[model samples]
Target: MNKERNQNFKKKKIDAESSYYYALSHEIRRKIIKIIGDNEFTSFTHLKKELNVSTGTIYHHLETLSDLIEQKQNKKYYLKELGTYAYNSLKDNIETIKAPQNEFKSSFLNKMMMITSKRFIMFHKKDRIYTVLISLGIIILGTIFSILNGFTSFFLFFIEFNS
Candidate 1:
């Protein structure tokens, strides 16, 4: 009887682990875990607003995440122990998860623009001076190019007028 009980317990544990990973498999479910974990508690309406998905979609993902999350009497959802674990894991490995795949080649200008935009959007305090200097350099170069182009056009007009 004790051996049978132990087998049952092991089976349930395996099921729980599978369910937890299954919940993490979907993007929406991961987002839900992050939202709830970050907020400690959140409402269905808040999730819907943040996700901007159809009601049915939210319902489906929430159902899948049932093992990870729980609702309180006040109708707010919060991460369960498993949910918290998932959230921490997700947070820790988010960079790896979001790393861009080299599926397509981008032009040098495109890569530069993306790098500059990302730096502008996510720079740290230590990078502030570097970012500002790079931005100023770009602006100065643009202004110089514009002025030179204007002079070139004026010189061409002057020559054409004389001709």
Candidate 2:
């Protein structure tokens, strides 16, 4: 019975730790942590202002982080020892999550490729036939004109030679 209770307690702690890490993975959460670290204390309003996030979003993230840090007074939050340790452990990984340059490039490329693919698909069978017909008509007209002009020049030379 004691062993089972200890196991449950450890499992809860691990779950909390995982949740804390997942929350901290977000860029906004990292900014919040930095802001909290700088101020040492912060309210929801100030956090929303500084982070430029919706009040609900800020509060949700704060609540998640607070749960990891442990709730103390009502409407107030602080990072406890576990929270501090989690933040420190995640510091390096958090820095990489900021701005996401690679993700932006990939998204841009995907959009470009989608647009190009649509344009290629827009070339219907009629359009293809029209292009081929136009090209063939131009070639035939040029060939006929060239042959007629060549015959006229040859006939003129023959008349001059005979005269």
Candidate 3:
């Protein structure tokens, strides 16, 4: 009987340890526990808003963490035995999630896009006129030069034939 009781106690301790390990293994779950530790019994809406994670992701982590954490009567949460263990496990490494402000990187990218768009528009507008003028000039000059050269050659041939 003494041996059986000892075995049962060991099993229960192992189960609790395993649950703590599982909860603390994920970064998101660890962060969740830290948030809950600081403010016990927060709503799901608050977690979703603060963490900036999707509903599905929050729900999954919360479900896994619920086993470790304690829940209040109002479906709020507190630190159960396993939760306290997990919270302490990740206390030092818990990271706070903050939303990034619309900063220089995005503004710079938008400016670059605007500049490129304007340059392309200007090039398209001017390119047609430039191309037509160049083509017409080349055609006119070529025709005039060819006619002059032909007349000179014909006059030289006539003079030689008469001689």
Candidate 4:
């Protein structure tokens, strides 16, 4: 049980880390974070000019990064603590990645993982809690029955040998 709990904790941590990266994997979002991270505050207009994206596109990226950024009273955006950490982490990590020999392999693996995770989540949601309980009950009953049968066989062998 203790081991299972540890595994679950590790799994949760991995899921959260992977989800964070997945959210930030977009080109526009990464640029927005980089721009906001370097400066004290950036207005929507500056981001629009830097990214050369439409106002709506900038707003969408902002919405995606809402957790990391906060709007000031003057309507400029600044990174929260989380945003700063994310920016620095991205900068450090992305700088280390080199062009892979197997670009197709990397993309294929990512797509496969995405599809498998989606299907797994759907199946997990649909699985009933009672099914697990019922399986445990069946295993327990089977074990008890097997032990009783073994005792009966031993008793019969002793009685016949004594006679």
Candidate 5:
């Protein structure tokens, strides 16, 4: 019986730890942790206002974050011990966490704009001018072709009608 009880306690502990990590995985819950950690304590209304989310969203995240945060008799939410640790870790590593995302965004924009690489046709001023001239030349050629084709078709129809 003692062995069984020990096993059950270990299982519960593991489950709780998993739930704690699960709560931390969500962006909204992480924001909640940061907000409460920053203020030391905050009311539900304050969290709602700060997060700019619906009441239901706040409730759902608060429920999920139950293990990390708790409300006092004063009716404000405060971080529990684990929550404080999470807050500190997140605060410390925020730059490291965001660095890759920022880098990806900048690199993606640079690739899309083609402002950095000279291999693309529109990088230099001369290349841009050449591209514009080529584009206009194509448009003019296409317009002229269409006009000639239309006149030929009209002349054919006129001759066939008279015949």
Candidate 6:
């Protein structure tokens, strides 16, 4: 019985991963997954409005993702365990997918991000204090650089106007 259960679980996981890949293949489905995952529980009307799609269109996509999302009480939709797995996977990989392929550094950055994140996670598995600190530091530095760039651009514009 235990062996049977393990086989069942493995089968379910494989089936779920296939469904997830199919569901995420469409742009609308990906958008729907993101919104549903974000809101915890989303209504059909809310999804239609946010996605700017017709009721029929929403329903079509929902049907396509039927294996992933589950309808709840009060006309709300949420991800089941399998759906949650798919959503988490999508969230983890979305950055790589969303990065513009037209840019040369996007691939390099994505690879670097993956490598650094894996190392960071492994090293800080016990505690995330260092991770938080590093993230905060990056945000601060990015903000400072943005402000300086803005000021520099404005200064250059002023100089150009006076000449």
RMSD per prediction, one decimal? 17.5, 16.1, 18.8, 16.0, 15.5, 19.9
Q: Choose the strongest candidate by lDDT.
A: 1
Ranking by lDDT: 1, 5, 6, 4, 3, 2
Who wins the TM-score comparison?
1
Q: After superposition, how far is residue 67 of candidate 5 from its true place, in Å?
A: 0.6
- Model 1 over residues 12-37: C-alpha lDDT tens digits? 89988999889988888988999999
lDDT per model vs. reference? 0.84, 0.67, 0.70, 0.74, 0.82, 0.80
Pairs with backbone N, CA or C atoms under 3 Å apart (clashes), candidate 2: none
Compute the lDDT for candidate 5: 0.82
> By TM-score, how accurate is candidate 4?
0.48
Runs with alpha carbons beyond 4 Å of true place in candidate 5? 98-163
lDDT string for model 2 (1-163, tens) is: 9999999999988987787778678888877776666566667777778888788897687776765454457655567776666667667566787747564467777678544545445667767775566557866776677566553234234221221
Q: Estimate, for each residue in 1-163, the C-alpha lDDT of model 3 and write its tens digit.
A: 9999999999988987787788878988887888887786577777788889899998888788867776677877677767776676666443422223333358776688544535444556657686566557866776667566553234234221221
TM-score of 3: 0.52
What local lDDT does model 6 show for residue 101?
Answer: 62
Candidate 3 at residue 126, lDDT? 53
Residue pairs in candidate 6 whose N, alpha carbon or C atoms collide under 3 angstroms: none
Q: Model 1, stretches more than 4 Å misplaced?
A: 95-163
Task: Give the alpha carbon lDDT tens digit for every residue of 88-148 in model 6.
Answer: 8889886777766644477786677654866566665554787777778976776677566
How far residue 110's Cα lies from its native spot in candidate 5, in Å, is 21
